[model samples]
Target: MEKTLYVASLFFLCFWTKAQENKPYNYFVQESKIVDSGNTIEVNKKGDTVFVAHYKRQDLINTSNQDFIKTYKGTPFFKNGWYRGKVQTGTGMEWEFVMAYNIQKEEIYLSNNPNMEATVMKPVSFTMEGHTFRQYKNQYYEVIYEGGSQIWKEYGCSLIFSNSSQRTGYEAEGGDEYDGEFLKTVKYYLKEGDRLREIPSKNRLFKLFGSKSNDVKNYAKTEGLNLSKEINLVSLFRYYDSL
Candidate 1:
């Protein structure tokens, strides 16, 4: 009877050791520009599991390689390079990782991994490189300022065809057909609640405040701030919102 009990214990120990040895792969998550110790399991790179925190078995879908880089002038990305960022996925799971937002493509690319080739992230919102972005009407807008009143910036990329072509006639048949400069657009919006009003001209930016125009002028002058700059306008928003 003692020998049988010993054999049973040996079998259990062997099974536990095998399970530990065969433990699955877990991809660590990057947060605030650092990859911290991991938790949770999710799919990445087919059959591989990603370890993350504050998530209950959320799945990452739509994995594919980026196939549109060669056709664009420069890049449609908000920033030219990737940076560590936090993304709140559709499942409400927040994953911090290195990523790039392609404005033209309207897609976020998961980056910094050797085998990184997939983006299934339907991001509810994301913060990257000190800039916070949220979706407004299915479009991504940078939240430059958020207070009682808010300032949002929209980004766009457009390809402008070259008009002055050195090559002429047959030489230029296919030469400058697709050759063009990619132009970027930055537009601002003012939000009170569900409504977003476009700030048409920068000259009229301060004028919208009406009664508070003098206060804005005073703040800008005291701080030696260039009110024309969009970023500096955030300081104005902070003061305005307080009132």
Candidate 2:
């Protein structure tokens, strides 16, 4: 009888441990504290209880860091114009604001006046147009898929200074007054636990699916999906989660 009781106790202990591991909890985002010089998350086996933090090398974000906005050949924002979005503060209070993401400077701006801009003072998650975005490192990545794991897409930009050095004929005609246009760049990633892996190419993404690779291929074939497209890629993950 003692041995049987001992076995039952052991079973209960194991079950209780798993219950703790699987416990669901909400994430609290902190803008001041960050890990690895970027927004960091700790994902568990069940992907519950996301712990989020953010950081970057840029000078501290301040509303008074004012310099008037400059014109660019192409939009510097992930969205071309101001959009209404919700920004959650560190204290868990959320507010609606006019928001735009400046991809080149890697900063978020919110203003009541769409023509004016001010840097957001804290790390935040916001939606632009219809897409949701969260900071990862110095950049913000869109949440493309979420399940036991998550898939994020980062929008990237680079500056192209005038080509005065390369101009053969005249320095004046070398590069126009324009600073240079925004050549958009994007990258996809898989976030599992503390590991953030980039899915650089279509082939790499397929292989990363592991046991689900064959199913993914079959599903894509039947649905006529081109994984290169963001919407299609998101659908594939949802389908995989359903299975």
Predicted model with the maximum lDDT: 1
Distance from true position, residue 149, model 2, in Å? 3.6
Residue 98, candidate 2: alpha-carbon lDDT: 77
TM-score of each: 0.58, 0.61
Residue 11 alpha-carbon offset, candidate 1, angstroms: 36
Which digits, one per residue and each the tens of the lDDT, describe model 1 over residues 1-99?
698667655743554455346434122211122222223234444543322232222224645321111122344456655678888755455666677
Error of 1 at 209 (Å): 1.6
| Per-prediction tally of clashes | 0, 2
Measured with C-alpha atoms, the lDDT of residue 44 in candidate 1 is 46
Q: Point to the candidate with the largest TM-score.
A: 2
